[model samples]
Target: MGAPELMRVSVFKRYLDELAPLDESDPHQLPPSLLQDLRRFKEHGRHTEPLEVLAASMRHLRNVAMHLQDGERVLPLTLFPRQCLAHCPLSLHELLQLPLDNLQVLHVEPAVLRPPGDPQRGLVKALHLYHPLPLLSWEFAMRGSREQLLPEIAGYAAYRASAVLDLRPLPIPTPLRNCVRRLQRETTSLRQLSEWPGLDRAVASRLLNALYLQAGLIVSRSHPAADTDGWF
Candidate 1:
């Protein structure tokens, strides 16, 4: 399976600390009502094209970040994974690392993205964002720590897969301006990202995936710089 070329990290030094993206506080600390957006989203949305499917879910994440504070919704923007430990040993983290050919994204309710076998109702179930913090911590412990990207960026990447490549939100502690600048400047796919001075395919993929979750990516199959990685 070939993947589409992913855009590099969309970091801009100017906006690094100037604009606070979203509250880095725990997700559960927000409000109980917030989960309803995720719940309803998980309950519906089934599309085939990677971009189309991603938009369906990411719309809510964007809402979560920018619409949060003062009951306005942070929508500064985002999105998570786990709980399949019952019948399947593959954590959502592991599934994401698999090449796109191996990854399976099923559109089902009860909030399981792509499942080989649905776990029994009473069992551990999927990454139910109804209560997100527990699983976030659990996944962190299970996956260990990764300094490859910023805390915010890494957290976002943990849940995202395919994206067209976009940018960082704002006011991040340590914005990867180099990465962000590259993507913002041109339209490139995952395969084409190798042209960057220091980015390997793996790092490029990780960065693109992270951007996708943060709503920092864009999909364009027609750009002269764009080419499918066949991983889609």
Candidate 2:
């Protein structure tokens, strides 16, 4: 409603110039694929558009460019559907530039750290090398939507192994209240929490994503059973 954060006017204008043919006199023009990306950029940049859609458009544009150039897959990042970052310390622009691998390292449990020769390690190395531009754009898009996207930065697999979740005081939906109350009584891991009555793996993941967006969830890097006394 206000202004585009990730897709600024100046930046968009510059991109337009870059994609333009250097010599208009030359019959050659921008590639059809590149033009499609540019079209998406313009469509999403409109002030009336929803933030989530804009973010997705930005991500799409980036992926199109990346694939056309190198064929590398640019993974789509998820964000909490109800996140609010009005007072966040890190701006969307700044977060977009950070290394995704570093964020993953911070979130990943030590026990689950992939060995040097593992395929997971190769994937991480690839993400680091490619710069995670699409992921960052998705994050930027999430910042704009605030609630339309899921909140968690890392993928489900990243936290499946050693992640321990602790409940914090925050507004919760009526449907999840009882489940959350039980969690308050005892600490749980993603796997354990998902197994609870009425909560399947996908539901559990979405709830956690929502909690993360509200900044009302604590993710302990320690073993899930290390401090099983009570919610901290």
Candidate 3:
């Protein structure tokens, strides 16, 4: 049988109504004044691009539905901003400079950090300055500095312990690849010491002593327990 006819207006109106109680109760919903503005748009048929706006709205609603089905509670503030911009001819710069109080959501991604002085830096800083809203969870990936992006010796230590430290496959820079291989060798030696039955105390002590010395990149002797305890 053919699929049942879709209730487009009812579905869209239902989503808007679901969002309406917040004005009277939660304070985060769009104000009644903004709903009045939307009503004006509807009355005057001022939407020169109604189909485009509707498409954007439907997409936003789909994203909300998917998140809800996943048991996620946070509604993205981006939906309203995206809807507003859909039929508007604003550039990214114009959109970024719009008063933060007028914006619903601000999404940031790692690539925004790459260019350093990209216009997005101002937008990101402004968003932090104006909106006290908790950043959407996806924003976390954009939080780290470049130095924190590198692979760490501790990961190779775990790989070595698991007997899986294969250096040939990693497409790392030559110097870093050599460094990791050397660290892997030290990890393998430590694992060998751990393999001995009953672990001779003196041998284990010597092995641990050697590991302590060679583990400079992975562990700090001044703070040995800090590294081993995974505090980083």
TM-score of each: 0.32, 0.30, 0.19
With a 3 Å backbone cut-off (N, CA, C), the pairs that clash in candidate 3 are none
Model 1 score (lDDT):
0.36
lDDT of 1 at 91: 43
Evaluate model 2: give its lDDT: 0.36
Model 3 misplaced regions, further than 4 Å: 1-163, 187-232
Runs in model 2 with CA error above 4 Å? 1-173, 226-232
As for candidate 2, its clashing pairs are 79-149, 79-150, 79-151, 80-149, 80-150, 80-151, 81-147, 81-149
Which is the leading candidate under TM-score?
Answer: 1
> Candidate 1 regions off by >4 Å?
1-175
Ordering by TM-score: 1, 2, 3
User: Which TM-score value belongs to model 1?
Assistant: 0.32
54-130 per-residue lDDT for model 1 (tens digits): 33334433222111111211111122233212112334443234333322222212232232343554533344222
Cα lDDT computed for each candidate against the true fold? 0.36, 0.36, 0.28
